[model samples]
Every structure is written in structure tokens, then in C-alpha cells.
Target chain A: MIDFENVKLKIGDTEITIGAVLESNGSTSNLKTGAWRSMRPVTDLEKCISCGICWSLCPEGCIIKRKDGKFEADLDYCKGCGICANECPVKAITMVMEEK
Target chain B: MAIAGLPEEEYLSCGHRACAGCGAATAIRLITKAAGKNSILVESTGCIEVISTPYPETAWKLPWIHGAFENPSSIASGISAALKAKGIEDEINVVAFGGDGSTYDIGLGHISGAFERGDNFTYICYDNEAYMNTGIQRSGATPYGASTTTSPAGRESIGKVEWKKDIIHILAAHKSPYLASASIGYPTDAFKKIRKAIETKGPTFVNLFATCPTGWRSDPAKSIELAKLAVETGVVPLYEIINGKHVVGMPRDISKLKPVEEYLKVQGRYRHLFRPEKKEMEINFIQERVKENLALLLEYAETGH
Candidate 1:
């Protein structure tokens, strides 16, 4: 087995893999796509009815079920698509402009 | 409580580079959930492949392979053969997917060959209408009167002159054991059809209508609503062709269909048909065509052919 830690071999000033193959799966999660957001979805927990429609329809699969049995998006990966807000049957989620 | 009776496990992880509110991404999430953990995914060179696997990063949690745009089906066939050679063909499901550009145009031959050979795999075509990844170029699946970069609606032209290719009928003629048409608008139906397609043996195909907010110039959040409107207006009928028998799904009756204009007026691709002058003739033609298509499917359902 190849040591993933040393898989990248330095060549002068650049680094390259042995065969350019990625052994690690789901590594894209390291990328914080939430930075790409211009709008943020703020959910009202009182009106939110844990129906999971937001979770099911989210393209990023970033929506998580909270401890209170309500659902909200993990802002670390949410791109502020507003799909959850648009699809929320209870109108609990609202899209607000993100402050830089 | 329970996430609407759907699988809680997610195979397509977050933080991938897919566009915000991407219908294809939603479709992929639903598909991977239905395929479960004991499956391998094969993807063609399209939006999903580009976004999901960019260099050393990957969004797929399953064992996935990327093939050329025109040969994912061919690659799937080889994988099926290898699985059979290992005597574990029945233990794993092989799912190959592509965009409309790859499925309805570039990869049609490879898909046909695989189906003709009865390859044990599932081929899904997530059709976003045009080649959105390549800047909205017209493809075989580009609907009639829709403007695109290659088929622009100008003073001299009226968008794509040709009607969208009937890819479902083309695949159905191969006598595949299972074939279905679904849209992201109806998630439950799409999930059921995808599960059925994966469970069925031999070559199975599902044409999933995915919306492109960028290409169509529609509201990103309205992707699912637009998809639903497509079905409600009979623009995209959900149906199944099991062993050469056609079974129409939602919007089964012609009278139940909402006006085709309700679906068309939302997307910017069809905006030209209404602006400068109301292209009454074109709208009428489209409405008639939608009715005719639904009528044909209803007839096929009644005839069982």
C-alpha cells in the first residue's frame, strides 16, 4: 500500500503524484464552498417543521437535522442557493444578503 | 422524524463545485441514495464529472470511474464483464450516467451497443436540455423553439428548428427490460423509478429531466418548480416502457394538463417567442405538439406497445 502522506513527491519546485491517482474519497468537502455565497438562508426554528423537504431537495446535501428535530443547513458547505427557502412549505427559511 | 421515508445516507457529498441550485446535482444525490452503498458509479465527461472530480478532490463516496464523453456505456459494459468474471456480477450494481450532450448525441451509439448486448447496467440520462457545461450549445435534446448559443433566436431564425430527438423511443426499440422517463420535479416518482431501474436485471435506462438555471436563464431556486411545470404542462411526460409496454405515469389524462404557455413563460430561452411580438403561431404550434405527444403516449399506454 502506498503511504498517502508521502504520495506527493517533490520535483524541483513542483509536486506530482506517483500516477496522479486520488486514493482519498470525498475529499472535496475540504473546499469551503460556503464562501461562494452572496446570500444566506436563516431559518426560524419556531416555524420550521422538520419535514426534511429542505434536506431532500438540497443539491449540496448540506442540510442537517438539528438536535431539536428541526432541519437547517450546515453553512460550512451551503452555497446559499435558496432552494431550501424556496422549497420550504412552512416559509420558515428566509434568504438574507450576506455581509462581507 | 424520519427524513420523509427516504434513505438518510448520502453518497454524493457536499462542497463539490456544482452550481448553486443545480438540478443535476439534486438528481445525482437522489440517484446515489437509491443505488445505495453496494454499487459502482460510472460517469461520462460532462458537468457532473467535471464538478465532482476536479483533480485530487472528489465528491463521490462510492467507487466511481470517469470515462470519455461518448463511451461511458462502453466502459460500463467492460465493468459488468469484469464483475461477471469475478463471479460477483449479481452482488453489485453498475450505474452509468451522462448529460444530454453525451447521451442524446455523442454517446448514443455506445449506449445502443451496450443495450443490444444486454449489458447488466443502468444508464441514466440527466437531460438539462442543452450543453450547459459547454456554454449552452444546442444538442439533440434541445427542445424546439428554445434559444441557445448555437441556435440563437434572432430576426432571421426562430431558435432550434428541429424538435428534440425522441431518445426514449429510440432506446425502447432495443427491447430493453426496463425504461422510464422521470423529472426532478417529482422526487418520489423519480426515486421509485430509479430504484426499480437499479433493481431490474439486464440493460435499463432512465431519462431524467433536469433543469439548468444558468442555461435557461431561470431563477436558480425555481429549478424544481420549472421541472414540475414541465410535467404539469405535458411538456415532459413521466412514463415507463417495461418490456415494450408503455405505462404512462403522472398527468395521465390530456384534460388535466395545464396550459403549455404556463411552462414556457418562465424560462428565458423561450422569452423571444413572447417579446417584440407575441408569436401566437409558434405558441399554438408548441401547444398542439405537446397535446399530440401526450396523446401518442396515452395511445401507447392503451395499446400496451
Candidate 2:
């Protein structure tokens, strides 16, 4: 949320300024964390009650409520904590391993 | 770690680098939600601090400051004083937090000084028993019979031989208006206490029971379950000492409660205690101590002195 795009770090033997160091307050969204995830959450729309439990429980805020009253996970950010799958009351969500 | 409800807030966002199913991280999320955006979070150097804010990155949405292992209380008191001096004391909430190593051992003097001076702030200690951030070193708050790197259980020793330092009683003796021992197992209860502590004038404290899955040799998914078992077993009593009156928060029926072994069985640190080579005496001692601790808490709750 705060501007930290300018912060960078060059750790190796090359002249590269990797803006990996985030000295900003709440600058986590800049990081596309999908690649770090070993597994991901997939939703079964038919069984979803739109209870918003996963929406509330997602630590990553990757689960979004669609305009049509359905839910989808922004896999680009979801770390597959399995909290959504664990909290789903109607067995609507499942976590599957990410394919390389 | 599943369908268990967390408040609909994104203060501590993902990709901030905390171990999976970290109870301390969970406690941080809950605290931020309760404290809201218009607050100052002062954290001591520990697992939460190290994991949340690695160099340029930070997980906090609020204005947060990092302090040394023994000085969050000192810095928070100064901040609270400065806020009052600027005539906007009510506009900001000053909160300080750290692990049990910082609270029960290292920063106690500063904490006592702040409490004695009546600083306007809320101090929460997420007690994980050991110096987990530094690779499972024993601290004063570590339970007896729990093995650690420093207090390893072997041929000549039975892990940490000392009982947990009674933090609630120590803080209560300071005559702080609000004090409570919270567990991650019962999050609503923890939230209620944190809100109450924030609202209370002057200094307040809450010692939170946070489970360390790695240090405790526990299952990641069972973090909350182990925390709940702690309260249910009376190993960590839930009570708030307000104005010298000890009020019990959640009372378990001791008659129906499971044995202390139930708590130990889930943890790998206590693995030696359950060995088949006959370590019955240590188990019996730990069991007796757990019961004794519960009986003492019940006494405090009933007598209020």
C-alpha cells in the first residue's frame, strides 16, 4: 500500500539492483506469491454457499467474492494454507499440489 | 488451521514470511485486527519481529516500531508519554509485545518500571515457553519436563527442572487494573481480553499462550488444538486479575479433564518422558505438578487474593 518500489538489493557478483528489500509499510501486494506456493486451492462452485468463511479466513486475502455471488481464489497470491479448504462447510474447496 | 474463523481483516498480509501454521503469527493477526489501523505496535526482537519484518519488508499495516529484546516496554512508555505531551493521547493506541524470553526473563525490569509509573499503553506477551526464535533455548516460562536444546532431557536430567514463572501473579502484584492469560485455542476469549486491555486506562497486560510447532515438535495443523488442550488440561489457566480480584475466564471441569500426558503426547520435546524404558516417575511428577498448578489457580480465582 505504501510506495516501496524503489527499494532494491544487489546480493551477487553482478551489477543488478534487485528491489527485493521492502522498506515500506504494507507493501506485500507488490510480491506475486503464487510461485512460492507448493499447493493451491480450487473451488467447486456448485457446493459453495457463499458463506464468506474462506473470504474472511484467508490470511493472504487471495479469495475474492465475485459479482455473481460466487467465490474464486486469486491463485497468483494464495499460498495454499488449506484454511479455506478446512473452513469450507459444504466441502466446496480442495487443495491440490501445484504443477511445476 | 482449517475452517476455524479469523476476522475479516488483512492487516498482516501474505508473503510476509512466517512458518506455516505459526500460532505466534496467528496471534499477531488477531492483535492487529483488535487494535485496528490507528495504533502503534512496538515489538521486541524475536520470532514475530524477525519473521514479519525481514530487512525492507514488514507485515504490519499500522505504524510499527521494532525494539530490542529487553526494551519494548521502555520505548512504549516513552511513546505514550510523548503522545500525551502532544495532547493527542486518545487518538493513538500504544501497544508493546514480545515472546516469553523477552517478557518473563529479559525485559521484566523495564516492564515493572512502566507498570509502576502508570504508563498509558497495552502490553501483550505471546509466551511460547522457550526462546524458539533462537532455536529452542530454555527460558524462565518454559514448563518443567519440557525438553529444549539448552535443557535437553537425557541420562542425568529431566529437561527443565524449574516450574514456569508465574507472570500473571507478578503483574497482578504491580496492581495493574487489567491482566489475563489467553490461549490461541479460544480466540474469541483472547479478543475480548485484548479489547478490554486496550480500553482500560493506564498500563495493562495479557500473557498469550502461543504454540511453537517446530520447537515443540508438534504437528503444524495442531497448533490451535494444542493451545486448546493447554487450557483444557489446566496447564495454562485462563483468568483475568482485575484490580486484585481474580476472575476466571474459562473454567474446565477438572473431573472430566484429560491427563497431563494428553498435552505431552502431542509434543516431540516431551518424547523422552513417554519412552518405554520406564520414565514413570517423571510423568507422575509432571502430572502432579499440573494438578497442583490448576488447584492453585482455582484457589486464586475463588479467594481473589
Candidate 3:
């Protein structure tokens, strides 16, 4: 058996393995890249319509839909490419400095 | 419930070695999302392969194999044959992917052979318009007037004097069950074409117009926008040729197409064209070429010739 503990992952209750999981879903899901962000996107819940423009166009695949259907940045893998902010059809996403 | 627009699975990982805004990676991601896990991939030497698979660590989750630049199609055919011999050909998709160098140039003979043999595989060319992995040399697929390293634009010349090779017509000439051209900007269309190409039992071909920010000398942020511009301006018309008949996908009305300048402006490779005096003649030539190309496709659609 392989020592998966040596590998980084946030399994979230799925039986996934090295060969089967292949190269996506944040690659190393447990590693949060939030520190890589110099700026972050702030979504106005009221001003935003859940058109999902940000969810699909994100290069990092970091923008995810919450249970309520509104989208938010995972920040874990979002290199803060700002592609979501640029692609947001309604201008609902704005980029701000990562103060924290 | 599925996330409305976001793809559910990630065949391409966030940590892959592609450039920050690599459009070819976007196309690769989208294509893998469509192909699903039951697929085995055959990749030729190209940017996608070099960057994704670095030694022991690989970026692919599928049963993928790397082949020489000129033999991905041959390898795919062998895989398909082995699967058929085992009576499991129907359950798996053998997809061969490469850059324009491999698809339109180096691997053309093998591609033709595979298609002629009616191999059960899909060949996808991630066309960034030049041999980008080999330092942006001009490939057969590079459009006219683009300044690649081998085809530099200077006082003696404007740029590549030859027009873009008509690979689509060549594939269509084989009476391929399915053949289409798509861009990374239009994921919906790209996804559909990828799915269709894989699902079709016989040979299929898809040329995905991938934008290369490094090779094209364009802003990484503008990659998708440039891809969108290519289709919107009819410079890279998105369409499917099925059973020897052509069908237009986007910009159905040719009149709505924007000028070539709109598509050329963002790319650094075409920057010199807009200098002080401007390469008015070349720009006009490109515009006319786009028109004639579309007109010929339209005519072919009507006449079936």
C-alpha cells in the first residue's frame, strides 16, 4: 500500500487514490494558496445575480458555488488571477487587497 | 446538484506547469472534462505533454501514454487495436492530442493513415498557430502575415507569405464522420465538439484554436478575449463538417463578422502591422483572405463539393 499520508489532500469523504484522482481539483487540495493572493475578489451578494460567469471562467477552478447558489472564491487555489473579476458579466466582483 | 456553469471534475489540476493563463491548458482542461475517466490518452511531444508530465510526477489522471511527435496517431491506433482485440473497444475512448507541429506537420502522415484505416480514436490539434514548444517557429498551421521566429516580418518581407493550411478540408476530404473547429473562448462549443468527436465510433478530428500569450506576445489576460475575437472576426471560423457537408456554428451571418484588425491588435506578433505607415496592404489581404475562406466554405456547404 502507498503512504497517502505523505501526500497532501483534503479527501472530504471520498475514496480517491493517487492513480484514480489524476491531475485536477486543486492538484493538492489541502494546500491553501491564499497567501499567494495580493488581492482578493469581493462579491456583492445583493448586487450579484448568480449567472455563474465567474465560476466557469476562472482559470484556477477556485470559484465555487455555495449551497445557496451564490459564488465565492475558494482562495485556496485562486492565484488571484482576477479572471473572475474581469469576466463577471455584471461587474459584481471587485478586486481588493488581501489585508489579512 | 451540478454547479451551474463550472465543470464538476478536474482532469487538469491547478498545479499543472502551464503558464498562468495558458489557453491551451484551458482547452486541455475542457477536453479532459468532456472525455471523462474511462478514456486513455495518447499525447505527442508538445507544450501540453512537456509541461504536464515532468519525470515521475504526471499531471494526467487517465491511462495516458506519451509518443513521439510524429507517431501519436499510430500509437493511438495500436491502443485501439488492442482494445478491440480484447472486445472492450466500445468502453474506452482513445484520444490523440498534439500541438499544430505534431498534428498539421510532423504527424500528418500517421494521422492520414489512422483516418484511412478507420481507427476508433479522436485526433485533437491544440492549434496555437505555430510550433510554440519549439520556440515559436512557423508551422504549417500558422496564419499568413504572423511573425514567428522563422517567419520574421522585416524590411525585406511582411511576414509569412503562405496562407494557413486547409487541414479541415483535408480531413473532410477523408469523409470523416465528424470534423469541427473550435476555440477555448467558447467552452460550450468546444465541449460539445470534444464529446462528439469522442463519441463518434470512427475517426474524428477537431482543431482547437488555442491562444499562446508567450508565443503571440499578447497579454495573458487577453488570451480568451483574443480567442473569442478570432471566431467573432471570422479569422478562425467555428464550424463542423459532417459527412462531407459543412455547417457554420458561430457568426452565422458573415456580415456581422468584425474586421481582422480587431483580432490582430491584441497579439504582439501582429504589432508591427500597425506601425507609422501601417501594413495596410497586408491587413487588407488578410481581411480578403478571411472573406474568401468563409465564402468557399459556404459554397462547399451549398454545392457539397
Candidate 4:
């Protein structure tokens, strides 16, 4: 029998399980997909309404409601698809080019 | 307060490899929310499967399993049977999901068998209209006149000549208790249908019209708008078939459908139809077909068939 606890292997700072089985759920959050963004979304809190359109429509589910009741995307995981800006009713979000 | 009445709990976490603004990802988020915590998801080999699970990492918060490209429904059936054996079949939800490549073509037989047996599960097909994961090859779900790598519209040929397969009608033929067609554009409606499908006993099916901006060559931000246009143009009607009775959902009036051109012009797949000279004949054909399909659905709804 294979010992579950002793078979850990490390790959580039991240530990990989032996059989491609992840013991923890939703571990993909560790991957920062924001690196794929060529554009970044900027939300205008002054004009923003907490309609949750951005939160509901976000493909990554990266948008979170801040303490002020306005929702903004977590840039660490946001890929900058611009759907939030496009679907924003009040035009509260705008897509800007990512800086090098 | 509840984020448009949807549960605040998220089952599909952030940071996956799906393209930015993927409609399937949006649909999946809503789906997992509806399925809640006590659920098992069976995934067919497709884009979501590849993107969500990248060896020792998974985006799914629920118990999930991936079978081959053509056997998600079969796996779901087995899972349902196991649940039944365990005597907790009614306590958990079993949801099988796949892309158009698997649902419309490769795994059609397996799905048919599962539906025939009245397995207690829900099968959701996120229809992006092509084999997007494998480089945009045409599938049975690919609508007519849409160009793909395999069905290119060139000097001599117009895109895919065949009409999209009426998958809902086929599934309804099995006398399944519930069958519905939804679109990511209408998240609330889609969520309701998903919850209802999961709550229903026996086999239920939901055809979710998801958009593929990468495959369709459409602007990424316009995915939801394109899906909305598809429904408005009568190209993808949102409706439910309950016990063989048609319950038409949106765009009930025949006069309300926007011209098919409005829907086609935004996507690069149909660019050939307009550029290098407009193909009026092809455009008219698509328009007529859309009307006829919606009219048929209206008749079914009226006749209680």
C-alpha cells in the first residue's frame, strides 16, 4: 500500500500530490490567472452601485464586495475580460491597458 | 442584498484557465450555486474539465469526477445508482455537464441511454455550438452558416450547411420529466431552471446556450450581449418542455424577434456572409429558419404538445 502522507513531491515551490489527486478543494485559487490580462478594469466607486452585476457576471468569480458596498474585482485573479465594464449599467467600470 | 436573490456562497472559485469572459464559466458559476454543497458533479472531457483541473489542483468545491469524452452521463448514472444503494439518493444532487462537442455529437448515445433509463440526475450541456476545446471544429450543435475550421466559408462554399440539431426535442422524446433550454445572458432565469432541474426526480436536461468568444472570433466583452442577441433573434429560444408539453419562455411574440443579421454581424464566424459582398440568399435562409423554428415552438406551446 502506498503511504499517503510520505509521498509528497515539490515542483517549483508548489508541492504536488503523487496521483494527481488534490486533498484540498478549490486549490486552483493559488494560481494567479491575472498574469494573462492585457487589460485591467478600474471601477469608479463614486459612481458604482451595488447591483452585483459585475459579481454575478464575472466568469472567474473574482469580484468581491468591499466594505463600502461597492463590488470590485480582485486583480490577483481577474483576467480583465471587460465584461464588468461592458455590462455595468452606470458605466462605473472602465477597461484600461495594463502597464508593463 | 442576496446578489439578485442568488446565494452569496460561491462554488466555482476564481483562478482557472478559461478564457476571459467565457460564457461557460459564467454559466458554471450559476450552476454550482444552484446545486449547492450536497452535490456531485460529473464532467465530460471538454474545455471546463481541462481548465478547472490542472493536476493536483481543482476549481470545483463539490465532489467532482471526470470520465472520458463520451461517458459523463454514464458515470452520473453509476454515481446515482451508488447513491441509491447507499440510501441517500434523495439527499444529494447529481449533475452531469459537458460541452456541445460531447453532448451534441460524441456522447449523444450515452446521454440517450441515461435518459431512457430515467436515472436520477441532471445533465447540463453548455452549448457553445462547436468543438471549441479541439480548435473550433464543427459539431452537430453548430448553427447553419457559421464558419468553423472544418466548415469554412470560401469562394465556393457557405459555412455549415446543416441546421443545428434540435437536441431538446430529442431529449423530450424520451418522455423525461423535465427538459429546458437556457442562456447565460439570463442568469436569473437560468438559475431557476437549473434549481428546478436538480430538484426534479429522474433524468432532467438543461441546454445552456454559452458563448465562445475565442471560437466565434467575437469581442470578449460582448459574450453576454451576443448570447442575449441570440435569444432576441430567435436563434436560441429559452423554453422548457415539461412532460412533452412545450412552455415557451422569452420572445413569445413572433413579431418581437430582431433580425438575424443583428445577431450575426457581431461575430467573425458570420463575417463572410457580409464582407466581400453580402450573401443575401444565405442571410435570408437563416432568417426564415429562425422564424420557422420559433413558430413551431409557439404551436407546440399552444397545442399543449
Candidate 5:
């Protein structure tokens, strides 16, 4: 049997192990197992003018710069502020809101 | 003793001040109702504090404390910390409320710090766009091209040159226990979100869009109407950023939503945007931005979490 202590969050229908929980309430006097929201980036390459506006404005610095200078967001760390989409002059970078 | 819903008792008495059809007042009333009588209100120096309390008196029926313009979250954090230290954590729910100016502008760092520290409190930002308490000045949360006391419509410029700050996502990055966005137009959703914030263990931040008739130069009665328009027009999509995921609760048909012009024309702040003589490119630019936002939100909903 899988150890309950070792068990982590299972995501999607496949239940892919994304990341282990570093700290669970751990008998803390007041803390509890918290819930989190996942944010994904959706870029329409056709509409994208390669303006790099999204790259410059990302607060989390999750947007990745390629060898070709084409901008793409790092899905793992992107918090989905929608600033990239909001600041995009050509309206290319958009936030894909993931439901709980 | 219903934990799932707001209390029926009115904690914010309707006596002292607040302008005619103040959205901040509605936010105060709604928030107090959700938090119940066993709650302490931490207010910043803005429209809510200025209008509700005139030094000698207050309109609040529950326990309330006023803080500086940029330190309501910190003040609330202190209150929560004190409660924990005194071992009376369950006796009262601590809530810090502020206007867009205090929240998205001067108080962002404080709000972020409180969240990062995992302060046990419910933080609500009643966003009415501009700094209404300070003569309708432009705030960081103000939308692009909207006229304010500071960003006036002139031959040189349209209005505010910046876009609204998304504090919910910022708080989400802190990995706070709970985070969400709500609006006065969606009372049931707003009530649910705030109730969740109160019941949660760690820090909870909710960004509420409050319609300001005085600030935005709109009809007082159109507060709720404009509020609904904000959600529909994608100017402010209704969503929750819990933990780290972004979720838009209301994903109705975009075709049913009124045009950007319909929402813009009613508010005098955006009158310059609708000018017939303006270059077609600038107007088209605004239109494209709105459409792109709507499309992005809808697409996000499709790829289910």
C-alpha cells in the first residue's frame, strides 16, 4: 500500500504527479491544507506580432525567451496575472484560466 | 448560526454620511453582513473612511478601527496577530477593507507583505477605479484611457494611460491559502467568496469591483447596471484565483454581452473615447483589446482544470 505520508496531489484524469506538498498543516495550531489555483498561458501565434511586451511585463518572470527571441511563458511558474494579455499591444498573449 | 451565509443583522447603520449611491457603502454593508457582528473592520483612509466617519461619529454598528491610507492590511495583520497571541482567535474575524487607490496603488506592497506573511485575516479591496476620496485622482487600478481628476480629457491625451492592476493573481503567487475576485453585481457569488475567505485558515484576499457614480461620472442608479456591464464586457471578468489556479465563474455567451461602446457611452469618463473625430486606429485598438480579453477568458474555461 502507498504510504499516506508520502502521497501527494494527483492532477487531471491521468492523475499526474505534478509536485509534492512541502508542508501539510503538520499539526500546526491554526494552519490547514490550503487550496491553489493553476494558471496557463495560451498564445495565438498568428495574431502575435512578436512584440515582447508580455516578456517585459511578467511580474513572476515566468515568460521564457527562446534562442530565436520568440517569447513563451513558463507554465510551471506563471501565476496568470493576465498582465501579458492586458499589456500586449497586438493582443497575442492571453491567460488560460484553469478551474479548480 | 449559519456558517454558509451572511448574517441578517445590519452592522453598518445607515446614519452618518456616504455620498448618494456610494458603491463603497454597498460594499461595506455587504461585507459586514457576510462577516457578522463578531467581526472587526479595519478601514483605510479613503472614500469609505472619509464618508462613514467624520471624526466625532461613525456609521458602523460593529467594532471598527481606522488605519492610514496605505496600511489597512498591516493594521489588520496586527489585529489578527494580537488575537492569536491573546488566544482569542475564534472570537472575531479580522477584515481589512480599502478602495482601489489604497489597494492597487499605495497599499499593494503592504497587502502583498501581509499575504506573504500568512496573516490570519480577510482582506477586501473595494475597487472603484479612481482615488475618489482624493478628488477623483487616477489610480494604478484605473482602466486605460479613462478620464479622472488627474488624467483629464484634453486635446493632448485621452485619460489614464495605464490598465487596472490584478491583485488577485499577485496574491495567488504568494501561495496564500485563499484568493478570489468578486463584484457587487453578483451578490450570491460575492457572498460565497467572502464567506469562504472568512472561514479559511490563512490569509484571504478578495478584489471587489465597486461602481463609483461620482468618480466615473455615471448615474447613481446605474451602479449595479455598470457593475453587470463590467463582467459582461470582459473589462472585469468574474473569477477566483484560489491557491494558484485561475477560474472564471461566469462564462456566459459573449454574443449576449453588450458592445464595449454601450458600457463606455453611459460613463462620462469615457466620453472622449467615443468621439467621432478620433482616428479609427485608436478606437479599433481598444475594441481589439476587449475582444482579445474575452476570447482569452473563454479559451481558458475550455481547457478545464
Candidate 6:
């Protein structure tokens, strides 16, 4: 089973961790730069309005909301192009542009 | 052979580290072609100044001077005055170059002063519409609903909450002999405007909408294409106010014009405006503003004032 808590995504060559739960299933590779790193979307829950704008606007459609109504960005399919942060209406998301 | 009907001599070098697909760089290239060899360039503090000249080396091929962030117009005015006093007005043409940050926000005072004095110079604002040198900070020219470092995505704020200042109209207020707006998207038109401004006797102003790849989060190859879309979408109209007369250029078929979505989608700055939870009211507000502004400009042009 995948741990939605420790779930992380790869955007470009950077690794992004989403929540507290960490999970490992398979290896991921960076297609653009050929560098290896995990990427995840970090959210300031205090600022999030549960608007789900990030989920709808995610090009990869990797973001999912929990049963408790809190939205979570799935890092496994997240591309880390920063469109989520750009799309977040309530300024709940920020794309941490990290260098590998 | 002349690249753009000018000599092979270059005023801007290629080694300067501008953001990939920078409109300001392209503006420099075009302005150099129009100004030719006998010109003085005044650069304001912004992306061009910070990236091109890192304390020592500069990429300028002509006589270029760096001024404070808000002083390109004032400094160029001073140069023109001194040149006139020295009886060297016949020897050199004064040209001032700055980004929108310096031109619209910090440099408005200097621009007003020069225009009021009717200084013998041509001022060009390579408008990228933000404080790009400081990590994509918002300025006066940043359109409504566009995100920036200072105007981050957040609740109750749709990015920059203001419309772009009407620079040509403001210059018109100064009663400048020649004033116009151009875009790198329209090279021939831009070239013509630059040449016309330089040839004018008194102070002239040209505000060109240059694209920024890094700040806008767009593809480097699509810089010019995006600039063109800005014009077509009526986001940035191409027109001139010559001797207080408004002359609109290239009347686009608004019927064939693509939705503002197409133009906004390509850049990361407007990414927030394209969401579902994002109220259509916000997007509609922006759309209405754009239409209103364009209509006002068109009306002014139609009225011949």
C-alpha cells in the first residue's frame, strides 16, 4: 500500500515531499535533465481553503483529496512544473524551485 | 552589410547574460540599429544593468551610461542639455533605454521632467512590466491578476490588483512632439516607430512591450510570438500620440482574436486565474478591464485626440 503521508513527487530533477507519511514503491527517473531526485508539493494547510484549484489545474492530475476533505498533491505523478503554485487561488501553494 | 538598414557596427554585444528569450535584449538590439553610431545611451538600473554589467565588463558597443533606477530620462535630459550647450547637438543623438520598472514606477518623475522640458532626445522603455531584476517583483505595469514575487497567489488578492498605466497618454499629457507604443512582435512597425522618434526635433517616447521568459515562465522560443499575442489580444495596443494626436496602428479583427486564456495560459504568471475554484468573477473582472482599456484607446484614436 502507498503511504499518502510520506508521498513525494518528482518535478524536473528535484524531489518534493508532500505530507508526513513516507512511502516507497518503485524508482523514478528525470526525463529532462536525466538527474534523480524526489519532488513533492508542499502546502501551507493554514492558508489552504480546500478549493481544490491545484488538483483541477495540475496538468498531470496527480493531486487528490483525503477522505477527511484535506487536499493532497500526489508526488508520484507530479511533474513539478510549478503550475500548481501558479494556479493556487488562495496562495496556499508555492513552488519551491530547488536545484539538483 | 547593414543588419536593419544600419551599419554592421553593433551597440549591444551577445555575451551579456540576459534571461533566455529576453525582450529587453531584443529591444537593445533594435534600438541600436535605429540609433546608429552617433548616439548616447542612458541605461536605468534593472535587469539589463544588473546582468550585463557585473561591476566591471559591459556589453554596450556605443557610448552608454548607467543611471539610478529612476533617473534614465533625467540623466539623458542632462546629457542632451550639455550637448546642446557644447554645440555638439549636430554630432550625437541622445537615446535613453529602461525597463518598465524604471519607466512606469520609479522613473515617472524623470520622464515627466524631460518631457515637460521638451529635451532633444528619444526615450525607449523596453517594458517587461515588472521588477524582473529583483526576482519577478510586481511594478506599476504588471497587469491585473498576474502573479509576482511580491504579489504572490493568495486569498482575496488576484495577483496585482491594478491596471497598467497608460504611458503614451501620460506622455501625451507632457505634450511631447512624438510618442508611440511598439512591440518586438511587430519588428517592422517597431523599427519604423524608433526611427520616427529619433528623427523628431523635440523629446520623443516609445514604449515597447518586450517579453520576459524567466519572469513570465514561458518558453524561450515563444518570446516574440507572445509579444505579438499581447497586441492581438488587445492586452497591449500598438499606437502613437504624435503632437497630441492619437493614431492607432494595425486594427486587429477582435472577432478573430483568441481568448485571453490562450495568452494567459502560456505564462506561469496568470496560472492562478485558470482554475475552477478560482471565481470566474475575478477572470471576468480582468477581461472587462482589458476590453474597457482597449475601447478607450480606440475611442481616443477615432476622435483624433
| Candidate with the greatest DockQ versus the true structure | 4
RMSD of 3: 5.7
lDDT at residue B58 of model 4 (Cα atoms) = 89
For residues A1-100, could you state the per-residue lDDT of candidate 3 as single tens digits? 8686455444686544554334442334444546567778889887778877666656656677777888988876666656667767788888888885
Model 4's number of clashes is: 0
Each model's lDDT:
0.92, 0.81, 0.81, 0.93, 0.71, 0.74
Per-residue lDDT of A1-100 in model 6, one digit per residue for the tens? Answer: 9886667777688666662111321111111211211334578888877766554333233456766665666654454545456556687876565465
In the range B198-225, model 6's lDDT, one tens digit per residue, is: 9998899999888888899887546777
Candidate 1 runs further than 4 Å off = A1-19
**Residue B199, model 3, lDDT:** 93
Chain A only: TM-score per candidate:
0.80, 0.71, 0.68, 0.79, 0.55, 0.55
Q: Distance (Å) between predicted and true CA of B195, model 6?
A: 1.1
> For every model shown, what is its TM-score relative to the native structure?
0.96, 0.86, 0.87, 0.96, 0.71, 0.73
Task: Tell me the spans in candidate 2 whose CA falls farther than 4 Å from its real position.
Answer: A1-23, A32-95, B1-7, B276-278
> Which residue pairs in candidate 1 collide?
none
DockQ of each: 0.79, 0.31, 0.18, 0.80, 0.01, 0.01
* DockQ of candidate 1 relative to the true structure: 0.79
TM-score of 4: 0.96
lDDT by residue for model 1 (A49-89), tens: 88999998888999999888899989999998898899899
Task: Itemize residue pairs with steric clashes in candidate 2.
Answer: A8-A19, A22-B56, A86-B3, A87-B3
Report the C-alpha lDDT of model 1 over B1-305, residue by residue, as the tens digit: 23865788999878899999899999998899888899999999999998998887889899998888999999999999999999999999999999999999999999999999999999999999999997999999999999999999999888998999999999998999999999988887898899999999999999999988999999888889899999999999999999899999978988878999998888999999999998999999999999999999999899877
Runs of candidate 4 with Cα error greater than 4 angstroms are A1-19
User: Which is better, 3 or 4, measured by DockQ?
Assistant: 4
Stretch of 10 with least lDDT, candidate 3 chain A: A20-29
